[model samples]
Target: MLIDFRPSGRLRGKNPVDFDSAVGPVLNALAAGRRDVSRMRVACDWVQYRENFRDIVDVRPVLPRPDSAESQAGQAAGAPGYDVELAVDVRRSGTVALGDLTAARLAGDDLDGRVYLEDWGLAGQSCIWDFNALYWSALELWEKASGRGYEQALPGGESDARNRGAARELISGLFTVWDRLAAAGALPEELYVAELGVGNGSQAKIFLDEFRDLDQTGERGYYRRLHYLMCDYSQYVLDLARETVVAHAGHVSSVALDATRPSHSLGFLRGKTFLLYISNVYDNLPTDEVAQLGGRPYSVQTRAYFPPGAATELAASVSAEPEELPGLVRRLLRLGPALLADSAPEHIGDTDTAVRFWQEAWSALRLEERYVPLAGLDLYSLAPGVSGEELRPLLESGADVRMHVSSGAVASFVDSLPLLHPFGRLVCHDLFVTKVQDYRVGFRGPGKYDGSVVNWVNGPLLAHAGRRRGFDVRFEPFRHRSGGNIMTMTTQPGD
Candidate 1:
């Protein structure tokens, strides 16, 4: 048997995992059972985030032989395979979790009452995104109630795009390209530049402000011909951004569109945009995660849930029963807080009360995870045109590993690529896991950032996709920030 332990920093001083209390009890229970358990591998991990949910003890087969009796019985029983590999979550008290595991194992219970919500398919397709959309759509209410903006929750309390140095560098590069195009008499009549996820428009303001100032001194004449587009999913954020760049109103336009399918909305700008800028947006988009264990690929399926106790408490707080909580949460995700309040005035008295409920629900929300086998890589689609074949080298490159497909990021990247001019470049600053090994060492995320999901983009897979499309993709640390997770990804037409 192989045992692996990956504990968080907080667990360093104390015993991270108690083998006698946790592992020994489960092993003893299995030993007493009819099933063979001699070949099992055990892994224990401490999930640092309170927002994440993991089973106390999870068991699965690691590459079961096809002709083995265990495999046949697993098929007959509708089980994935023999539970040969066990994963334990050390977040809960070891003895208590082991007792629960042993009790369920011995009694043959399905562990039903622990689940507050039913399975919702894969993590990416779950209703979490619905809540995420509602959060952004009704961001004004969230910010008002929290007494702070979403940007304040970021590592530096602001986006790196707002850094004057970074903005100046990007603007300078654009000016150089525009200058060359103009000298060659190939510049378009209307110079176009687009910024996606224009949070508060501060980044746009800085870029535009610098562009105008630099143009005045250099006499590039590009600022006069410039058309800046501030694009975002939230009209409220767009409105705030518009006010921030009101000085350059004539030169700017606010576009309310989905970032994942920019081409669907900005098809007119195909090959017209001279530069596309994105900041801290891709990570928030929906993504599915996949993992490889013993050369077998599995998709990480998840169901968003509230713990039983939290569910009862939340329901009681809203004057509802625990059984009625899912429907109410569904209603909250479907409708913004205001509409939910308007729709269910008895339960949620006002918009403020609704917002509070939303906050509490978000705080209590967790994800239960399981692994389902992938049929094939070629059969999987990362985006509309991009294939799961791109994930092949990454997954098989090393030992057992798990990583995000960054489905939304890839779709956005592929769709937005068509909008770039021949000399255009796409610049994005966000959380990126540049190496596959990173996923093996620690959790990348599905962590909550205020009200939205945040996952590290699969940078290497993205680079592969870009290269397949004849674009050169590269990643580097965010130059302006020291000791940050943010990486700068630049995609441009290859030579």
Candidate 2:
């Protein structure tokens, strides 16, 4: 058995111990008496911090495909043939154990620590977020006043200050454009503004309030002709948003629609809508990360999340088997089961139990990542027939590229473009990374925010995609300050 260990990136400074020296003895202990241990490699992708490397462990399994010529050639050359991947994380100290594999705890500091098994990977995988249907399904439970969710989840909550600034900007830009279009007789009889992911509708209220003031003073009559649509996937959020925007009921309409596929429900608004607004929504959408390893492009494969101890009880209550979470989540979403009916006692049936379990499990969940080759990869579909290749230029960059595919964001942006009136514009504020190198330093997450997943959008890629579609795309710092992390992206029809 031959094992290869490669360090990723250059060493910035002195470390507690060198990568090879720190991990060599631990691997020896794991490999001892294991006949199946053949050729193995460890590509260190993170730097040691405080004598510990807290980073994702990437495990790629090279398996022979029955129909592939490459597999046949490899077999002829006496190459190993298996589709299993073993994840190894070397900590400063601890006994290593994972499903079917175990390593003895070493006594000395000859090598700094032990190699712990992080995950066992199969060859093929899908987007993990696609399967994470439970969190959104159970959203209503955590969106209440007592529930632990976003600041905008509850009714009567104040809108983010940045939202106020965004509203002011929208008013300024839209009013000027409206005047020009009205003068040219190009303006639609009825003006439209769509807000996707309208949490509690506070932002809508602020914008409406500002618009009304401007209309009464300016005598533009734009507000009289305005139609404000609040759209969200969750019916509960839509209801809450509607309540917050009740003052503008005459001009407002609420719809339960998937933001990623807005056209499905909003087709009637094609080329009529004046503005499409989104706030802190793109980061919550499902995304996939791809990397370029040694000049070869590979997709990052995700297994299920590992729950912390605090959430152990909740996780166990919600899912009997962690691997089957997607199916379980779908079932629970359809039928709110207080307990795993088949596994739990009959007395344990209450909806609150299910809701609590869902919230806790989400708070504790942390995704695991591995690398799979790009050949025959299950790239996430953007639109029904759209392929992920639209993002190839970004991921194919020479450096070890790891960036969010933002498939949903791309699809939403692409689909929303056609819905805009001639003078219409799309305005969105989100965590957007403008450079591929930003990922090389550290990719901005799949982080958990209460019950939601927050990932940074690949801004440069989205900008590139917009340009190809003949739209003028621009990115600037968020007008309202909560954090500099948020960037405002605007797209308008090309001249």
Candidate 3:
């Protein structure tokens, strides 16, 4: 059979390895060795291509330490370390290319620790979305200073005239569902609706306002019975949302929690919620992408990089010796620009300068991609003890599967199912790519949006995962907006 190769990374056809050709010998080897043959095997050897990459795999001091200012200053004054070639192990399971591995702090570490990808020409390539998740943890400070985020500054404001029409479409559907539940005597004493990523709370106000209007019609007192839970990772956003929805305070409750791991924070409402509402949140959560090359699947690896000449002055302060870039970036995010400068005044200047430097550095960040062959389908943990084979439908779509493996989205989506009553539904509106063809066109994003990461979610993958869990997943174009790419995903029980 002739093979078709789908290169998720930039290095397409540079290495013409076939999936079937590469997999069969490995399978045969496993069989001869009396090993399990039910796994997806991959064939790869570290090719000696010295020109494209420098080998620093054996460098000393794999990570940076929290040294004194004087010590870091002395290190930064030294010559830069050479970049290395590091390949992480890929197991039989279809996981852990570069994106699945937790980031290390240095280049010579067990895993490739460098964060800047532009130097390696991997800038703008697709990566696992976890970096974006980490990046948002720092935005609470930025938002405090700027008083804005993705939602507040969303193109034309989230509730603009055009967007309001979509809100109506959303509420109309909710009205229909509410009517069905009330008529069937299925509406619980306290009807639950949880909105993840409440943002600036305008969406909640709009939703609550609409619900109140619907309640005025005297259908079944659903509005009075409504218990709306606003959930978000940022306390800053949550507090703001609470204020926005102050008029509906009696019906509203706020939960500061990670949208990805909703189960940990939302376990109290298991099977009690009627609707789990999410808007533009899933796209920001952590995700991993996988691609099939010549029929054999490979997980994509990514590292962050700064573009040349973008933030040269600030970049110079970051240690390029023991590879202090990731560590420095982490410190900058965690401490904020002021504290970071305060802590390292020897080189990083003062608060105002540091803040400016931070913005410059952030805008310069990019991504690099590398594809790693997998051993089989056993290593990826979809659920406890579930094999990666369960995800094949999502990955092996015949065309090159540049799948954004939104593990967080899957976790949140699956966990939220228990949050819903029998007839309850989970409704989410976000930038979603509902087909494989969408990916073949280009990389969706890890787009920087005012200190936050905005990516078009892998809709097809999430739908596939939802189906595996016995839920009906459907995608519809957002009716309120005409030009933007917002799609609504409504999931309910297949039964």
Top model number, TM-score: 1
- The alpha-carbon lDDT assigned to residue 118 of candidate 2 equals 28
Weakest 10 consecutive residues, lDDT, candidate 3?
53-62
When sorted by lDDT, best at the front, the candidate numbers are: 1, 2, 3
Candidate 3 TM-score versus the reference: 0.70
**lDDT at residue 471 of model 3 (Cα atoms):** 90
- Per-model lDDT: 0.81, 0.62, 0.60
lDDT of 2 at 446: 65
The C-alpha stretches of model 1 lying farther than 4 A from their native spots are 6-41, 44-50, 53-112, 118-120
Which is the leading candidate under lDDT? 1
lDDT of prediction 1:
0.81
Expressed as tens digits, the lDDT of each residue in 174-202 for candidate 1 is 88887788889988889899999999999
**Model 3 per-residue lDDT tens digits across residues 1-495:** 111122234234675434443334334433454533232212232222111211211111112223446335644775222112222111221222222221221222333433453232112233323334434555565555566665565666553322556566666776787778767876567878888888778888888887788678756577788889999887767888899999999999999887767868989888887778888888776666666644545555666654344435455654343345556666665676758877667657776666656665665554545555554556765433235676687666665445666656777777778777777788888889988776664546555666556668878777877787789999988766678778889999888
- The per-prediction CA RMSD against the true structure, in angstroms, equals 4.2, 7.1, 13.7
Once fitted onto the true fold, the runs of candidate 3 whose alpha carbons sit more than 4 angstroms away are: 1-149, 157-162, 178-184, 307-311, 316-326, 382-387
lDDT of 2 by residue, 180-273 (tens): 9889998878899998889877888999999999889999999999999998887777888888888899999988887778988899999888
